[model samples]
Target chain A: MNNWKIFSNGLFKENPVFVLLLGMCPTLGVTTSAINGLGMGLATTFVLLLSNVTISLVSNLIPDKIRIPGYIVIIATVVTILEICMAAYLPALHEALGIFIPLIVVNCIVLGRAEAFAAKNTPLSSLLDGLGMGLGFTLGLALLGSTREILGSGKLFNATLYDENYGILVFVLAPGAFIALGYLIAIINKIKKSL
Target chain B: MEKRLESNFKNMVLVLCAITLFSSLSVASINALTAEKLNEVRLQNQLKAIRDVLPAFDNNPMEESDTLITPDGGTLVLFPASREGERVGTAVKSYSNNGYSGPIWLMIGFTPDGAVYNYTVLEHKETPGLGSKMSTWFARGNKGDITGQIPGSKGLRARKDGGEIDAITAATVSSRAFLDAVNRASGALSGNADAVSGATGLEASPGATPVEQPDATTGATPVEEPDASSGATRVDDPSRTDTSLPDTTHLSPARHE
Candidate 1:
C-alpha cells in the first residue's frame, strides 16, 4: 500500500472506533464529556504510536509463540510511562482520566495494530498507521462525547448552549452511551456507504 | 516479509525476559523522573483544597495544623487558619467509611463557632455521574448546600433520612456518607469527640456530654486535642502530632520549578 493510503486507512476506511469497533471499553466509559473523550483519545493515540514503532522495530527478534505477551509488555510499559508523565504535568486531566489511563494497556486497538499492521510492516509505515489509527480513535471519541454532552447536558465541551434543565439527562448516563454509540455507528456507516 | 525467529522454548523464554526487563527499566526510569513532580502536584492540590474550604487567612494553616483522634480510631487533621492575629477558620481532613462504593475524604472548614464555612471533596471512589456529584452537590448554591450550617445544631442528614438538606438524585448513600464526614469533622473541631461517635449512629448515648469545647479564637494555639491525654482512645502517636504536614520542603518549591 502507498504511504498516504496506509496512514489515511485508519482515519476513515478502517477507523478503530466507528468502522473496526475496537477499544469499546474506553469508548463507552470516558466519553461523558467532549474534553474527556479528547483526552482519552490522545492518551490512547500516544500509546498506539509508541507501541507500534517499538513492536515493528523488534518484531523480527521476537519468537512467534510469545509475541502476544511481548506486545502486551511493550504496550503496558508505554502506558505506564504515559500515566507517570500525565500525573506529573497534567494533574487535572490525569485525575479526570483516573483508572482509564491504566486500562489503556488492555485496549485492543494497541495490540490489534501491533499484531495486524505493525508486525508485518516497516517501522515507518507502522508509525504512520499508529498515528492514523490513534487520530481516528480520537476523532470518534470526541464526536461521541460531544453528541452526548450536547444532548444530555445542553452543553458542548462544557460551554453551555442552553439551560441544562431542559437537556435530556439519560444521554449523560450509561444507557445514553449505548444509544449514542449505536446511532453514531449508523450515521458513520451511512456516510461511508454514500461515499 | 522479514524472516521471524522460531518459537523454541529457549527463544521464547529469553525474548519474553528481555522484553519484560526493558519494559520495567523504562517504567522505573520514567517513574524516577516524574516522582518528585507527582508529589508536588498532590501537595499543590491539597493546599488548593485547604484554601477553597477555609475563609481568607494569612497564616500557614498547614504549619499550624493539629491531629486529633476520632472516636472510631481514625485520625482527623485540622488546619487552623488565622487572619492577621485572630483565628479565621479550621479546615479538617475528615473521612467517612459509609459511602456507596467506598470511603470518602473531605476537607471541611468551620468557623470559630463551628458552622461550616466551605468544603471540598479530597478523595472518593463514589460512582460517577451520581455519587460523584457530591463534589459540587453541597457547594454554596447547589441543592444540597451545607455551607454555613452547623453539623450537630440541626438536621444534617439527607432529606430521605428526615434532614433539611436535599440529597443528590439517586445518590442518597453518598450524600449520607458526606454528611457523616462533615458531622465528624465538626465534632472533632468543637472538641466534642463523643458527637463523632453519635453521628455515626453506632453508639448514640441519649445525653452525650460535650468533650472540652476549646475556644478556637485564641492566638495560634492548637485547638482542644480530642482527648489525646487519654492514651487509651488516642490513635495518633504522641511523637508525631503534626504528621499531617508531610515533608513541606519537597512541596515548597512546587510552583517555582
Candidate 2:
C-alpha cells in the first residue's frame, strides 16, 4: 500500500521537475515556447516510463558489478528509439527540439525515479511512477513556456492576446527565458503549498 | 550448488538480452510508423525558406530539387526557379567570417539575369535582443547607406555601447555578435566591397538599393562569391552549412530580421 502511495507522490509531492530540480538542462533549454516544451517533456516521459519498467524487470538479473552500465545501455536504447520515431514522423518537432532529444538519455528525472522507486517497486507500480513523473515534468515545461510565450510575444500557442505592435519582445529572448522559468517555478511551488 | 548458480547467471543474461531486443523492436516500430511525416517536415522547411526569400514566385512553389551542387570546397544549396523546365530564379546558401558570431550563414537569391531578388539569415548565435533584431530593427534601414543607425553596429557598442541597434539589454555579447553577422552577410550580398566581391548580377541594382540614398558610406562590402574551388573556403561547404532556418524566407525586422 505504501509503495502505491510512493508511486502517486511522484505526480505532485516529490515531483521531479518542480521539487527535486533533477533535470534543469532540458527544463530550461526546451521551454522556449509552450509547444516545444510540451513536445520535449512528453518525449522524455515516454523514454522514462519505458526505461523504468525494463530496468526493474532486469534489476535482479543484472550483476551488481554491471548495474550502472546496464541501466545506461537500457536508457540509451530507449532514447534511440525515441530519436528514430521523431526523425521519421514528427520531423518538424524533432528538428525544433534538436539535440535536446538525444540528451533525454541523461535527464535525471527518469534515472532518479527508476533508481529511487521503480527498481524497488513492482513493474506495474514502476509504470505508474513513470507516467506520473512524466506528467509533472510536462506541466512544468508547459507552464514555463506559457509564461514566456505570453509575456514575450503576448500569444499563447500563437494565439495573439495583445496587439503585436505593443508586444513585450524580451520574453522571447534567452534572458527572458531564464527569468520566466525562475518565476514560473516559484509560482508553481506557491500554488502547491497553498493547496 | 555450483551448477545451480551457473544456471541462474545464464538466465539473468538471457533476461537482459530479451529486454534489449524488445526495446529495440519497439523503437523500430515507432520509427517505421513516423518516417513519412518526418520527410514531409524536412521538405516543408526548405520550401518555406525559399518562398520567403523569393517574392517573385508568389504562386505554386514546387517542393522538389531542381539542381544539386556538390561543391568541392564549400556547401552549395541550389534552389532554381523553373516553369515548364524554363529557368526562373536561383537562391544560394553562402557564408562569411566577418560576422560577429564567427561565421554567418545567409541565403542570397538572384533572378535569372543576376538581379538581387531577396536574402534570408539561415542561422547564427549572435546576441539575442539586439543583433537578432537586424531582420526587424533596421528593416527600413536604407540599403546603400552603411552609416544608417543600427543599435549594435555602431563603434565598439553592445546595446550598452548605445549603437542604433538596441543591445538585447542584457545579452550584449550576443547582440554585438549578431550586428557583426549581418554586416558580413550584407557585405557578401552586395558584392560591392572587398569581403568577397564578385559580379553584381543586374538584379543587385547596384546603384539603386532599397530606399536608396547614397553609395557614400563604405561598409565591409565583400565579393559575393567565396571561391568554391578551394577546399579551404567555407563559402558553400555543405557539411558546415547545415542548420535550421525559419519558416518564412523574407528577411523581416523580427528576430533574425
Best by DockQ: 1
Candidate 1 runs further than 4 Å off: B68-75, B153-155, B192-257
Q: Mind sharing the TM-score for model 1?
A: 0.84
Candidate 2, residues B1-257, lDDT tens digits: the string is 01111335666587567667876787778777777777777677667777765645533445443322222223335566665666666665555333334455656555555444555666654443334444443233432222233212122233343434455444444444444434333333333222232222222333233121122212212222223222233222211121101101111213332
Model 2: per-residue Cα lDDT over A18-94, one tens digit each = 78787888988777678988998899889988999987776776655556656877898899888887776676687
CA RMSD (A), model 2:
9.5
Candidate 2's C-alpha runs over 4 A off are A2-8, A163-178, B1-44, B55-73, B96-106, B116-257
Question: For candidate 2 chain B, which ten residues in a row score worst on lDDT?
Answer: B242-251
| DockQ of predictions, in order shown | 0.79, 0.35
lDDT of 1 by residue, B30-80 (tens): 999989999999888878999999889999888888776554577788899
Query: Residue A77 in model 1: shift from native, Å?
Result: 0.4
